[model samples]
Target chain A: MKQIVSPGCTTGPFFPVDFSDGSEDLSQRNGLAAKGQHIILTGHVLELGGKPARNMVVEIWQADASGIFRHPLDPRQQDCDPGFWCWGRARTDADGVYRFTTIIPGAYEDRAPHINVAILGIGLTRPLVTNIFFDARADVVFECVPAELRSRLLAKPEGDGVYRFDVILRGENETPFFVE
Target chain B: MMDDSTMKIDYAPYDDATQTLRQIDKYTPSATRVPSAPLIERPLTLSERTGPTELVSKWNVGKLDLCRLAPDSPRALGQLIHVTGRVTDEDGAPVSSVVMEIWQANASGKYIHELDDHRAPLDPNFTGQGRLVTDEDGRYEVFTVKPGAYPVLYSGWWWRPPHIHFSILGTSWMNRFITQIFFPGEVLNEKDLLLNGVPSRDVRDRLIFKPTDTVMGDLSYIGYQRDFVLRGHRQTPELP
Candidate 1:
């Protein structure tokens, strides 16, 4: 029998060093304070067998506090906060924990406040995309997800504007992943 | 609604040959095997469409050279190289203005990162990180030194082939992908498990970069070409 390799595990053990300013902190630009309520998002990434997934790259991108993006295509670019980084990246530690210091992204048009997530590493055959919605207005988005999987998408608020959202890559209670 | 004769039956599970055939599904990579859940079929929302834009600015300083962190520092030592390539969709259309982040170890197999505890001497002149945006023609080029092979203890005592990690951010969130580029004719290509993880020989061949004779003045810098075909359309069927 031929050996069957795991899918989505094609790319590497990418060690993303800080290439540019604001690469790790979305709440600030280089060292300047960004406009919005400062928040620290923390979580752990686990494998299907419940083992800590280490050295995996986790990237987050979100709109600024004024509900605007910094892209050239976004018409609402005028509302973008000049000091907001709007993006951040962190690799999991030995225990699979990754954290980012960013603002609570503002809700746009019909969608609630959320941060888009992308996970890449050796274990993944392809990049995994998901979203982390703040618990404040999560009900609006939660209604769209299946009842059993809705809880996995919500990030509970701890004190001091801190939020927690753990990610399970596989197994019985895997985190909800969105298709492209 | 009660057409019993037209209904599909499950009698195949009772046969020995059918049971063997059913096991083949386990070998294929699907949502059942991978962590990615099935995409919920729904129309795009405003937040999903307009947000998650390119956060890095186009005027970012030092977005090309990977070897030196500052102009005052001494230049990194190794064979000077120019890595050039084009970013295109599966249909052969150009993908312009996309951000590509590349990082790798130094020529001595040592990384400047704090987590890299390799005993190799660190090169003060080499920072090992760079970023660039594809031009209108979907072309990008970078100047850096050839990185040396490094040992990855987790994958046995063997050394990892010299390769550069790439993180590509396309127009939309769905178009985002990450892959590595390795030099051609590296003896360790056949031994590296991560490179071997790509089961298809043709797909694996696409990852390697071949050297070209293109020279820059009297600097004697090496030239490498490796094009990228990002996810977009299905592969065209081959003629028999």
Candidate 2:
């Protein structure tokens, strides 16, 4: 029997009941307000057969370096940067390309944590959530994620404020994605 | 072996992550040659419960403008009802300029997402995605194909019945909603811990199915209508 790694389906639901839509105009200020620096984190969603995965919903939520979320319900609004909503969502195209344009988040006291993503495709009972961290803080943040996602946190900073990370769904070196 | 009329399986173009085939890999001999499953007929009448329906109002429309369904979009089953509607704050106004992204499987149960690659080819005509600005009337339209039934990795098990995943963001940074919209009359709805967690029947009813409308355009697309109400201390938040 092939071993399947993943704690039973429940990845704590982060769905924002207050706001469920995914269309945010680019004109509005993104999570990083002052820091003109932005990174384009893009990747393709491929099926087990290696074809582009289309129409899959990809959601990402993270705290500003100051640990503030865009959610109004967030109780600890301390250091909440008005400039940073700190969360975004996108759908993968037929080519499986899903991209997010935002600023490099600063670290929080929560221990060098990184942004997390959850991908909910068809057929699964639960959603597949994963995390991505800054290369510099990989060591500290590595432990913040579960053992399964630790391997997939590897991200190479491509030139021009863009980082490239590929999500591997299966295999011996399979990478698991995470979310808080 | 030379007498065989079989051809070699081309695995080169596929990425390394996908080439590894194991028993779990549904795409082996059955995966590639698998014929498209027949779409389920939508249901007759879905009982609507009461309470707060998970609302999906647009906040911000992002750089990704395309909202066409993927080829993998489940053929609409007569039994499955789709419910799509616009969400706004307390004020009866539409929040325009937003994108509504949804994912689901066909009646046979399959998600169009690439990760669910074993089931269906990405529906070229169906994006399983849509975009809209609340009409001047605070209304938004969702154009998508119904979802299908598919598989998942749980405790040595499989699930049935088709459902949809919804992610709605505002036109600005203030509010965003992420939710899953389930079809009515599904036995799985009761089994689905998430669906039962909602407090009220009214809210749960909002997640039920309805017919797609062609008022926006044509009936070729599956349409589900529902309205989202985002209440807060104030009205719409300005774009940050």
Candidate 3:
């Protein structure tokens, strides 16, 4: 018998209130247009059995077009975009789908454009950390992953600055996860 | 290979007694256990390292008060309490300037969120949410009320022990830790399956906060201290 439940699920259900305010739409900050190409990232959170994982909270944090984060710990010399709200959070709906309206983040150091994702919900023991990279820059991070499984991390462009990146929590073809 | 026999090595072999103790130490019944799931491990890249940004302005936007959200209201409902703690690394060294986000149910066992539709009365003056930035000495303090225990529809009906949710973001993505703090001496602590999920008794005890006497002017608030040790050799165990 398993001795412990995952951290998030142990507390029972947590219906996170939308704490992001209007920051979900990263293209504009405080009503002013941000300096970057606006993009919409959409996906579904699925269980290992391929069932919809409903009520999951998904959070994304990324750098701005200038490749600078707003966090005080960041030691980079790049200037942060005052108009970009680099953090966003949302909950999955009944269909286990989550969407975020943001811009394509610029590259940082030797890495390409990617968005850092953290997922948590009732069944999750801890928040799952992962990355979503574009198909063009997938090679930069997916070098060690088999060619067959690399596509799981790629978010394909769906025309007009929109991308589709589904996240499968478990089972065959599950999305790649990262540990600290 | 150089001189195996000359080098002194300390070791303990597995035995029946150790096995039995291990079973007790790691035992968590399936009925109360959260099942294991698949996870991938990868080193963080430069982008991932620089991705997360502080939401300081957003957290500080409104009147920052966990006890009283409404500035006009003098005091929030329920017993006033003070929570103070320090953030440290696994080595017990202070980790300064870490950001912590916290939220909890109101004193009436009801959340301020719309999704919480329990029959309990909502405290309009209390939002039960706030953020704290650790000082140079890794110390932080917040004023809140004792949250009421609430019942959930688990196994017919199960009442959860009073707890406060915490979210801590360390310097790196690997240091992100989320967990709950429970008040010490609550009878329900022994029966709480969630609290029992932690296998180590000593580690589990670390999650509980003991009450202390702390006075603020003429008003006296119950004081509680709980320190958080971030990632390192003696890193605090996450819920699992």
Candidate 4:
């Protein structure tokens, strides 16, 4: 690899919770409701070897119902919902489970509706970067996901607005991470 | 089989896998957690190209100086030092407004975290956490003390030299870089398992920051510099 930076180091179970400064709810801003279908997103983060990844931090960023990102990088005209912050953070509990209260992200240019997730954990040398689409078969860029790995990246819907997704970091039913 | 967004953006196949960490076999945590499975290579769609910029500015985040809790607070116990660095992309262009968060052990080689039960004395005034934001030139500086060395638990006679851990958030998700800043001339740099895990010797040296000629703060604090190069946008002349 031409990249020359030092690879990375494990947090060694000493990560400071305040460093992340993350949130669990992105659907409301300053007590105002964000546009679109407000839903509950929850999941577990386990090692492919089946170890519960406790105290690890997860960050999620997505577009609002207008398919507009709150970020300045979205080149489109600024039109995101005023109440949606478009990003959140959650830490896995003792059972490796994390929960987030947000809304269904809308599809954007050439890409399907999805949530971008970046994770940092006790044992992970590098933060695992991945995305979770809303379905088994998503449109556009998701096609790049191999058919067999599609199940790993799709969010499984429960009875109501709650969605369950599991992130397996190594060895077994691991979700496919992305690199440009 | 690809999207016809030819008008919007061009995508590239997976950039070859990132540098692999050569396990030292002693650090049991990474040995089991490092993914052995292949990761999916994909294009830098909007999701990867954009992220929450200036996260620190929005929140009431403050604490760039670790030696002192606040400007008026008492200085933590240790030798105060100022760390300076520039963040750039592979193209050597500056990536401004990036948030760089750092965590380290106190001067006694002890972390304030509950997991760390080392007998080293923890400075009551020091939490050992600091954060900074890069300027338009991608330059950042933070005030901290030289952390002490501590032994690796369960590892026979393994000691980690003074090192600071860094998590840098760049323009996008893929640009996120996690690394450690080592002090130059520290004998421990040569013995650190995680530092040596990096395959290349040259890259290992890059992790060590060197002293700067000019002074940054009052004569009390010393300045050291190291520049970082994060992955940049893939070059595609064929794209619109």
lDDT string for model 3 (B45-137, tens) is 545543343554455533246877565676778988988888775455565666677788888888876656578997778868777777778
Give the range of the ten consecutive residues with the poorest summed lDDT in model 1 chain B.
B6-15
Determine the iRMS, in angstroms, of model 3: 10.9
Query: Which window of 10 residues has the lowest lDDT sum in candidate 1 chain A?
Result: A1-10
lDDT, candidate 2, A40-79, per-residue tens: 8778766555565555556665665454444333335455
Model 3 chain A is weakest, by summed lDDT over 10 consecutive residues, at A1-10
Q: Count the backbone clashes (under 3 Å) in each candidate.
A: 6, 95, 5, 0
Off by over 4 Å in 2: A1-36, A49-51, A72-79, A136-141, A144-151, A178-180, B1-240
Off by over 4 Å in 1: A1-11, A29-37, A135-144, B1-43, B50-54, B68-74, B214-217, B232-240
lDDT by residue for model 4 over B1-240, one digit each (tens)?
012232233223323233436245666767666667666667666777666773755565443788876677888989888888888766566778778878999999999876686889989788698677788888888888889999877677788889888887666666667777788888877878777766677667777888875454454777788888776534546646
Supply candidate 1's per-residue lDDT for B215. 85
| Top of the candidates by TM-score | 4
Worst 10 residues of 4 chain A by lDDT: A1-10
RMSD of each: 10.2, 17.7, 8.7, 4.2
lDDT of 4: 0.74
Over 4 Å off, model 4: A1-7, B1-24, B54-56, B61-63, B213-219, B233-240
lDDT of 4 at A72: 64
Ranking of predictions according to DockQ: 4, 3, 1, 2
lDDT of 3 by residue, A53-168 (tens): 77777878888887777754455524778778787887778898988999888876666777888887665545677788875554355665556777788898889888999888
- Which ten-residue region of model 2 chain A has the weakest summed lDDT? A2-11
DockQ for each model:
0.20, 0.06, 0.21, 0.44
Instruction: Kindly report which residue stretches of model 3 are placed more than 4 angstroms away from their true locations once superposed.
Output: A1-12, A30-32, A70-76, A136-140, B1-38, B51-53, B61-64, B71-74, B214-217, B232-240
Tens digit per residue, CA lDDT, model 4, A3-91: 43335556656667776554788887866899999888998888757888888888888888878876666766277787887778888
Q: For candidate 2, give the docking quality class from DockQ.
A: incorrect
